[model samples]
Target: MALIPKETELQEGLTTIFEDLLLKKEGVKKELIRTRKDFNIACDQHIKSGFQSEQDWVNANASHQNKFIEYEMYCHIIDIITDFKDIHGQFPEYMEMHRTLSQIMIKLAQDEKYELAAIAKLWVDRIESTIQEHSYC
Candidate 1:
């Protein structure tokens, strides 16, 4: 027979996961900031060059945008994972967690918490997109 994990065990496990994800998020955030700074410097250089090197600015802008997306995705994943751990005190199957989040989004909307509801909707959309993308693989 399989033994159930204790609450403390679950909490400890979640905490470990949270810490790891937080580290990754911080790394992404740093990269995002660095890319933004590079983009800004490129912009200044492009201006100084009388708009001669458009490619440099364009590449910097693309890098910054990619890093920003990565940072945002990490933030969303961390928030949703923390929420799941706080509510259920255990790791949830992805689909179950997604469904629960969807219900939460609806409840938040019904309660007139529009900002939070919108955030939840965004999380749900992210998760749905991830699932769809992985299903093809």
Candidate 2:
């Protein structure tokens, strides 16, 4: 017979995972803010000078795009966490979160955002490994 983890153990594990995710979310948010500011500054400078160097525009645009994607990804994560909490009154099961992450990974890949997709894949792998570690079979 497989030994099941106690409710408290599961809760503790979930708490740790949630905390880590939240921390990452905060970091993403900070980067989003900074990138937004940089993008705006770049635009303002272009408008004021009536010209922007090609390299400067490219750098600012790339940073804006990357941070926007990251912000969207973090928003999805927040939505998943919120919905799970609202429905279950607790942190989500690892597999449940994995399912959502898998969908995100596929969507990102479809969008040709391979780097973001890879990050999502890493999250999926981490959750699966957590599930495996907790399983007793």
Candidate 3:
């Protein structure tokens, strides 16, 4: 039988991945081009290995790239959140802030100004798909 991921497992996995990426934010930004290219290749390999079909792999790769960008953006936002918490000694109402940030992400994706948008979009799609598919089983 195929192993199906639970919703909690998916959420935990995504959170862990993003947090790890956040930890690498400075390294990634300092070496943007090289790091981004390396990240893309790694994502490609991961998707290729996971999906049985070539088209599915392509789709997943695209989605993973988008999510990578989105996570990068989120990392920056996290810095701001950290500052806010430092000042107030409490977390902000993050949901509203996240909504606004998501709008910015969509705009970035629409404008096609950065490859990060594609990566972020791809990331979200794959995670969502994985969660849904696993939950159904």
lDDT of 3: 0.54
TM-score of each: 0.60, 0.76, 0.38
Error of 2 at 23 (Å): 1.2
Q: Model 3, range 6-106, lDDT digits (tens) per residue?
A: 64464454455445546657555655555456556766776778744566446655655655665567575556435433243432333343444456558
lDDT of 1 by residue, 18-134 (tens): 576678789888999999999999999999999998999999999998778667756876777766664645555656767877887798799996755775676677666655544
Best by lDDT: 2
Looking at model 2, report the run of 10 residues with the lowest lDDT sum: 85-94
lDDT string for model 2 (65-118, tens) is 888888777767667756666365565565676788788889989999898888
Better of 1 and 3 by lDDT: 1
Backbone clash pairs for candidate 2 read none
- Residue 45 displacement (Å), model 3: 40
The lDDT, on a scale of 0 to 1, for candidate 2 is 0.73
Give the range where candidate 1 is weakest over 10 consecutive residues by summed lDDT.
5-14
